[model samples]
Target: MADLTDRGTEVGPGEFAPWPLLTMHLGGHPLDQAQLQQLLAWELANPERAAAWGITPANGPGQLQERLDWLQALAPRHGDLPLPPAPLEQCLPLYWQLWLPLALTLKQARDELNRPLIQGVLGVQGTGKTTLTLILQHLLEGMGYRAVGLSIDDLYKTYRDRQQLVQADPRLRWRGPPGTHDIDLGLTTLAHIRTAAAGEAVALPRFDKSLHGGQGDRSDPEWVRDVDILLFEGWFLGARPIDPSGFDRAPAPILTEADRQFARDMNAQLATYLPLWDCLDRLMVLCPADYRLSKQWRKAAEHQMKALGKDGMSDAIIDEFVDYFWRALHPELFIDSLKRDGEHVDLVVEIDRDRIPRAIYSPALAMI
Candidate 1:
C-alpha cells in the first residue's frame, strides 16, 4: 500500500496533522469505522447545500460516497500531497464538500454532452480559484479526461495594443476592468476548442505578468488537442452589463462626477463582451461575504511579500489599487445583483472572510 506521504510505510495516528482520519484505510483499502463516519459526516454536512449540488437525492448518499471514495483513493498519489504539505484540517472539508462533487458534476455534464464542456468560474483574487482548477485538472486527467484551464487573463490584448489604448484613453491604465481583453481572440479560441476534432491541435494563448516592469504581456501559446473540459475563470468572468442608473447612488471609491463617469463607461464596455459569455455552458460565481475583504486580503499578501524583502505596495497604495477597480466595476453594483440572477448564473458559492465557502446553491433552483 502507498503511504500518504510516500514514506512507503503505514502511517500511524498523529502522522499527518489535521488529517483526522489517522486510522482510516487509504490506497484502495476497505472502509473502516473511521472512514464510514467521515463519509456520513460529509454526506450530511449541510442538507440544503448538498442538495443544491445534487448530492442529496434519495440515492444520493450511495452515489456521493462513491465519489468521496474515489477522491480518498486518489489523494495520496494526486500530486497535491508530499510536496506543498497541505494540512488536512484546512483542506479536507473543502475537498469533500466542494472539489470532489464539482469535479464529478463536470464529468457527468461532459459525458452527457459528448463534446468539450466549457465552465466559467467568476471570483475576485484570493477566492481559491487557482487551487480549485489545479485539483479539478488532476482529477479529470487521472480518469483519462483532458481538462484544460484557460483564464480570461490569457485573453488580454498584447502589451503594445494596451499601450495604444492607454494613450488614447488615459483613464485606462490597468489591464482589468472591461475593454482590456481581445474579444475577437477569445471568440476564435473558444470556437476552435468547440469545433476541433480529436487529435487536432488548438493553440491557447499564455501571458507573463513579470514582463515590461510588471505590466504583463502575451508570452507564448500552449497547444492542446481534444480537450474534454475547459476551466475558464477570471476575476470578472461571467459579469454582465448592468443598468447605468444604478451608479447614481454608487458606493464609496466611486464618489465624484469623474469617478461616476468612469464607472458608467466601464459598465458600457461590458455589453461588447456578451458574445464571449454566450459561449459558456455553465457559470459559477465565488462570492465573498463582504466585498471589502479583497482589500484586506491584498494588504495582508503585500505585507507577507515585503516581510520576505521583496518589493511590495504600501497599505495606502493597496487601497488606491483596490478602489480603482471598485470605481470601475463596483461589486455591489455587479455581483450583488448577479448572485440572485437565475437566468444567467447557475451556481453561487458564498465564502466568508476566511475564504471558506459557507453556502452553495443554484440561483435558478433557489428562485424556483
Candidate 2:
C-alpha cells in the first residue's frame, strides 16, 4: 500500500516523478524485445554512466524509436516508503543498481531451499551496514517476502556482564572487540528465527551505546513475527579467527606486551563465534577500497556528534577506539580472506572512499 523506501517524500496517487534507474544493467540475462528497448532508453538518458556500466546505444533510428516508445510506458511505483525523503531506487543509486540485484539472487536461493534464510553482512564502521540492511529488508518485503534486521552489536552482553570482562582484562574497558558479546544469546536468537512458524514471535535485542555515560548497555527488546529472511549485520558479524602466529607481527601499534597478548586472546575469542557465524545461510561483506578510510570516517562521525552538542572522542582516543577492534583481528586479515577465497561468504560489495559501491563480487557474477 505504501512505498517501502520512503525517505520522507510524499506524492499523491498518479502524481510522482519517474524513478531514476540509470546505473543498473540487466547483467547479460536474456531479455525480450520490450525489455531490450527499455534498456536502450535507459542507456540513452544517461550516456556517460551507461558506457561505464557496459551498455551500448542503439545503432539505428528504428531501434532508438522503439526504445523511446518503451520509456513512455515505463512507470515508477508511487506511495509512502520506510526510508524518508525518497524511495530507495531514487536515493541510493548503488542500492538500486547493485545491492538490490544481490538481494534478489539471495532470495532466489532462499526460495529454492524452501527454508528460512539468514543473511549476514560484515562491514567496518561507516561502511553503511545498517543502511544496507534496512534497504534490503524493504526490498525483500516489496518482493512479497517478510524480512527482519539484526545487528551483532545488539547481541552485546549487559553492562554488568561486560564488567566481568573488564575484570578479566582491563584492556576490554570498551564494549566492542570479540570478548564482549553474549555468543549464547546470539546463537539462540538465530536458531529461533530460522525455525519460527508464521505468526510466531521472536524478541530482537538492542544495545544503546550512549547509555551509562557511553560505557553502553543493552536496551529493551523488539519483537517481530514470521520473518522469512533475517538480515544480520555488524562490523565483525562474519569474521573468523586468524592464525595465532599472525598476531606476532601486529598489524597496528601493539603498545605493550600485554596488548599483544590481548590481541592473541581476542583472536582466540573468535573461535567461540563460529557457531553463530555458521547460522548464516549467506554472508556478505562491505569492504572499503582502503581500510585506512575507516579512521577518517570515524573521525567525521565523532566531529558531527560534537557539533550536535554530544561528547565525541578526541583524535588520540579515536585511534585507540578503532584500534581496539583491529587489535582483535584486523579486517584486512579477516575480511580479505572472505573477499579473496572465503567459501562461507556469498557476496562482497566493494566500496570506495565516498562509500559508494564500486563493485560487487558473487559466485553468480564470478568476480571470485
Model 2 misplaced stretches (Cα beyond 4 Å)? 1-92, 363-368
TM-score of each: 0.88, 0.77
Give the C-alpha miss distance for residue 137 in model 2, angstroms.
Answer: 1.3
The CA lDDT at 63 in model 2 is 39
Query: Which 10 residues in a row give candidate 1 its minimum summed lDDT?
Result: 1-10
Tens-digit lDDT string for candidate 2 (1-368): 11223231334786432233231322223345665566467445644333323335545235333333322222132233344354333444444445445556656778976978898888888787887787667666766788889999899999999988789778887787897899999998998988888788999888998898878899988999978888999998888877777766666666567777987888788889999998988888887898888888889878988999998889899998888777766876777777764467767778777676656555333541
**Candidate 1, TM-score vs. the true structure?**
0.88
- Overall lDDT per candidate, in order of appearance: 0.79, 0.69
Which pairs clash in model 1? none
What tens-digit string does per-residue lDDT give for candidate 1 at 2-26? 0113121224785432234422434
